[model samples]
Target chain A: MTRYLRDIFFALAALTIFVAASPVQAQSNSGPLRIEITEGVIEPLPFAIPEFIAGSSRVEDAASDITRVIAADLAGTGLFREIPRSAHISPITSFDSPVQYSDWQAINAQALITGSVSMEGGQLVVRFRLFDVFSQEPLGSGLQFVGDPDSWRRMAHNVADQVYERITGEGGYFDSRVTFVAEEGPKNARLKRIAIMDYDGANVQFLTDSRSLVLAPRFSPDGQSILYTSYETGFPQIYLMDLGTVRARVLDSQDGFMSFAPRFSPNGRSVVYSLETGGNTDIYLMDIASGRRTRLTDSPSIETAPSFSPDGSQIVFESDRSGSQQLYIMSASGGEARRISRNAGRYGTPVWSPRGDLIAFTNQQGGRFHIGVMRTDGGEERLLTSSFLDEGPTWAPNGRVIMFTRETAGADGAPAIYSVDISGRNLQRVSTPGMASDPSWSPLLQ
Target chain B: MKLFSKLIGVVALLALTACGGGGYFGDSPISGAPGGEAAGSADPNSVAYFNQTIGDRVLFVVDEHTLTSQARATLDDQADWLLRNMEFNILVEGHADEQGTREYNLALGARRAASVQTYLISRGITSGRIRTVSYGKERPIEICSAESCYSQNRRAVSVISAGPGA
Candidate 1:
């Protein structure tokens, strides 16, 4: 099966090269035309990511580590194929000069990637460039990253994002971080802590010790901080952690209430979270700097999983007021809540799309859990994934893809992170160290 | 009407016992009512009395740790069966639906098991005789990907073990 997949991948690579070589097929020979990707069946774009050239850092770690990570990030999507290093007859060594088109074409590589790393200004400087192998020209200028050596994985993702954007004509999600709950130990005595890792599950640094149970760590829009709920003082409370200094402080240390399901607004100033009082969970927005809490929902029902619209004008949350968990949208300033999910089942975790057009949520009905999307006006609902257990749908910065947690059935089942495009074309499982869940995506780092 | 609602709530909530620990009625000669001979006949370590066909596993409300009346009733019988069979030891596995966060689900599962443990203790079952673990939503009794399956998945499963006796 692996060999067959590899051959099929090579064929697709050859096809991409052919398409790139064919001059832009003008529809009217006067203006740019839109090619119908076709209905019901859209082809996954084929591209080639050759092994990146090692930088001149002279690092003790394996030089191929950075390149391998970058390749894995792109290929993990099942959208792009990395041409086997053995297939390339001419190796790319420099990013300053143009690539040899004929050499790339010989191996059925449609696109070419070349990267270099060097120590500059006391920091690791990484530069990567993407090229259209057939067009024999650079797709975009070389991307340069400056960070410490400890963040080499992030540098790789940043480069992968650049490559992804250049080829797919869309933003890349590789340069993002995923904050999730990391669990350990046995079932009854399991210990969970909040941990942050690169989008591809690298550099897993726990933000809190397992001394307390934590859940739902979400990154701020600036990617400099995270807001989550922790059961530190015997009750769940909101806490904010700054990524720059690895320092954390309490957000709203209210007495005798559980605050959870925290997420940052688009502007990154105010954080919206759920406050449970008298067993009733309601959405509340709190200013991180001023520590002022404003009640957003006054219903007696369970309202959690609050997320902000892209423009921060409104909010979407899950409520059981209608007898089952469903998505509702209300103004950021708080008012009458409008139900946005008119689906056949219960919906929770209604995250507005970064494009502000749709809300992604977890829908339960018909004896299964599904990740679905619907318009903000309660129309055009579409189910993206169906599984024994699939929940917590967080969007990539571009709103092109959604990442969620999927677990198998039975007591010994393991939970893992999975990403699927909104179109449901690309589905890939991102393997973490152990059972992973509640994945929240960081905004684009660049 | 309020009194009737409270009565119904009491009946529904009777699935759980007020105590923290005790073995439910069974076939053994521990310390409880005498209809537990069926469980007493099995090996002390064997799970012979657990009936998969009965299908009365306890259920939990969304994000709630307290047991509902129906769930309490089910656990009441479970406790009775355990008390009658002194040789039986139980392991309560807590679970949650996929609707909530993973870690919170784990905590909620713990809360559910703790509730069950408290009920068993109150019913005269020894606390040491019952072991508890919370799988959160990582494990599901049902395989569907919808709300119905999730509702069923949110539960605590009690596995009963007994020794040969009586």
Candidate 2:
């Protein structure tokens, strides 16, 4: 069974396709066709997707599901708005038929996506084409994907990803996964278990039981293993668990020290985390394979929540050295650091964006908490959401969105996962099983 | 009527007695009804006694790990008691109020627990006999948004168990 799964994973890893719609990887050079995404008000561009054409009766459900997922992916970005079918004048019936550009234009659909679903020898085949309706041209060549029927959502995401990239010039995060701590019971006795799910909170699979308290499950750079803090042995120590076998081994089990807040380097070769010894908490880096350790900060103050830059050259972390929790950037190797956050409130949980431009963090001031983002130099600081508690910001694969944990106040207060665009728009709650906190986004999957 | 029933429930629960230290205290142990095998506060070495009389925890201000005068007083008594009871190994669990980020709170809690450990070691308690862990803001003894609850929530508890020191 293991060998069979490894073989299938390899096929999916290659994203193998049996049908090649065309070998064209060129995009038409239309004038300023790409949406230059920035941190500001964006009018969600209008798009339309008709029901996918089904090649056979056995694949009707697959066709409709794929179309819906593709539409959902584009709409969830807050960058594109879907045009309902009721507003459409023409329904796409054949995959090869020419698009009724006039009909789509009548409804103000700037972009149109057309797809078809078919099955051959128990393999699901999906193909799609994106057209700039106003330009009356196919943005790029049509692409096809072939995979197991169980991976239908992934195929839909692939199609939507291509459409988004063709229109926005930005990478798509629809095909990624997120790992978080699923919670149960009350606030005081809340039981936590590590769970992994699709980006939209589907396919929830619990990695660990609620027996031991687990917090902050982060994905490795390769997304094949997870690093989190667990109380399995009555101490909060970081543990690495392989997703293949669902087995875990303690990464640091020092006899008297505690370890937590672990993050992977961009290359996935080493891990950086916080270690507490003699009551002094400082950041430490460990070579995962050799178990060798390096102390990055010898501060008498708190320094934790370390995140590596995209190039693995530097790390951004939180510290209270100057007397309050704030953000700082230092070299990946231990060295002098400079403070980055220059505001009235305390800043924490600094996460470097994948695009190497912005850092997201949690801000607290005037008795309220907020999820905010700033430039790499801590300039252009902007608060995204304000509530009782909004923290632990994780960046999406495209670096356009952020997901964090927002908690309520009072006796019956609870924590829920929420997300927003980096522009401080479209704040939406992400549904999970029961209460959840500490969300971490995975890199775009292969 | 809802508040009345809750008050009555609290009073009734405080009236029960047990030697174990799970749910046996509420402000003060009013259950010392001169009963059998209770190991009440009158018994110097019992956990029930340690929790009720000697005070097994120390509270802290928000974001501050420095021990207060009252906290130091409690640890002084705790160290004295722990020295007399050598078979009793204690696990120091540090906690925080739900006002900070999880990672920061965990680091803060570790500092708070380390403060308690330092005081106990100064009071001549062996480091091996005292183990420390931080729950961050995950567990709380009080559940409200006010300082009345936050003061109690931000605490370091020394839970005693009868075993050889690690």
Candidate 3:
């Protein structure tokens, strides 16, 4: 299995180079038109994914399930529309067989994904290949992933990621996870728990019971730990929990001081959060290992929601020092700060995108709350979502999408997680059993 | 009618106790209860009376934290009540409307609560007897989106406790 993986990786690298060297074909000339997905309205590229051919009867069900998941992952992005199986001119049956490219092309399936699943030593080995139906060539070399049967969904996501990367020329966030607050009960006395799930909102596992309120569960850079603020101790305090062991410990728990809104630094060696001392709130950074504390801002005005840039050289945060809440960027080590948001509204929760190109934030103006994005210099501000209350924007690993909490108004109001492309398209409500909020997207799985 | 009013008061007390902290509407009387000053502020010396009559909370404009004249007047009454009841300590919970970011609202809530604390201190209240926490936009008295509801939701409520420490 290990040898098979090595050979597949080499073949993929070689195929990628070959594709890069070839001249791109136009849709009029036909073969496969290399989708140049830049900006503007996107008509989803139509694709066909047949059921994986099972190598043995034992893996038959796993084969079909994996294929469905892979198709769903691609279709959910709104970038690719899956051609219905009913429209297929041919069905894929054998693991090793010649493809009928003409048949797929006749059905207008520009891309075809085929795979096989087999059981080896009580583990599942899934190999897949993507073909440009019109180009009459494999878009990327065939590859396989080996994992336990329970992780079949992850393996399927891996395949989808490869296809997405090949077609879009960008990394895929399909295999990531989201940590959010699951809410229940009434608005006045809502019960909230820390819950983590697959990026598509599956396999939900509650990390904490709803005994106490938990807010803002942020994944570490490595996706192995979570930083959140909890009122379990009867006051707001920052807690770090390892996802594997579920053991949590409070950080910088100084007596009489309230700490919340904690975010991990880019390197995961330190955390920046808001600490309230004697009725004054300011941003503080603390080393995870050394417990060294550095006060980032000493202003009498409130300073919080500190987010580190991808390079860790600077931090963007929300402050009211300008007489109203707004975004400000300052050196990570703490010094002179410059205001970033110059709009006529209160901007807060400024999160630097993983790509470090844009900053997503919550903006309140015109008697409405909006989740918006702006360039690093606070220019080109674009509001992606507006509603009764939309806030707390978290970026996908690739920074192409953002997930936030949108709550309806009135006595029955409740929050649910929603995601949208950076261009303000493909708005989707993430599936959750109950009301959910404060979604923090994890980096892609290793 | 007197017996009915007393029964209503008992039920209101029970509801408040069952709520653990407080209801979303604060001390607003429940449905079917008499809708006058007598129904809400029956206990003159109690916290319920303070909340419903003497004003346990102060409202703020959209994002502003500066105290209004009405807020100052309320704080003056709260200071006098705190002085008279020396056995009690207070926790001021600052809250914001649901129109802001979670963390930002928290900071705004803290600012609002601190504004109240500062006013009370200026009115001769001891600093050590008071503690402040910001709920941000998490808890709202009015969950609607209009300005009327937002104005009510952006408030800081003083919760009195038994001890001198918060």
Find the candidate with the highest TM-score and give its number: 2
TM-score, cand. 2 vs. native: 0.91
Residue B7 deviation, candidate 3, in Å? 14
Report the lDDT tens digits of candidate 3 across residue range A1-446: 33322211221111112222233343232344355545743899999998999999999899989999999998988888999999998888875577899999999999999989998888788888778887787776677788767777778888999888888877899988899999997775578899988889887888899776689999999988999998776567899998877779999778657799999999999999999886688999999999899999999988999999999999999988888888999999999999999987889889999999999999988778888999999899999998878888999999989999999887788999999988898899999989999999999887
Kindly list the per-residue Cα lDDT of model 2 for residues B21-115, writing each as its tens digit. 22222122221112222445688875556666878789999899999999999999999889988877666778899999998888888888889
Question: What are the per-model DockQ values?
Answer: 0.05, 0.44, 0.34
* Per-model B-chain TM-score: 0.65, 0.76, 0.75
Relative to the true structure, how large is the alpha-carbon lDDT of every model? 0.67, 0.83, 0.81
Tens-place lDDT per residue, model 3, B64-110, is: 78899999998888898888777666778788987767877777787
Question: Which docking band does candidate 3 fall into?
Answer: acceptable
Task: Name the runs in model 2 displaced over 4 angstroms.
Answer: A1-33, A39-41, B1-39
Each prediction's TM-score against the native?
A: 0.69, 0.91, 0.87
The deviation in Å at residue B91 for candidate 1 is 22
Which ranges of candidate 1 are over 4 A from the true structure? A1-46, A49-63, A93-98, A119-125, A143-147, B1-166
User: Which wins on TM-score, candidate 1 or candidate 3?
Assistant: 3
lDDT of 2 at A121: 76
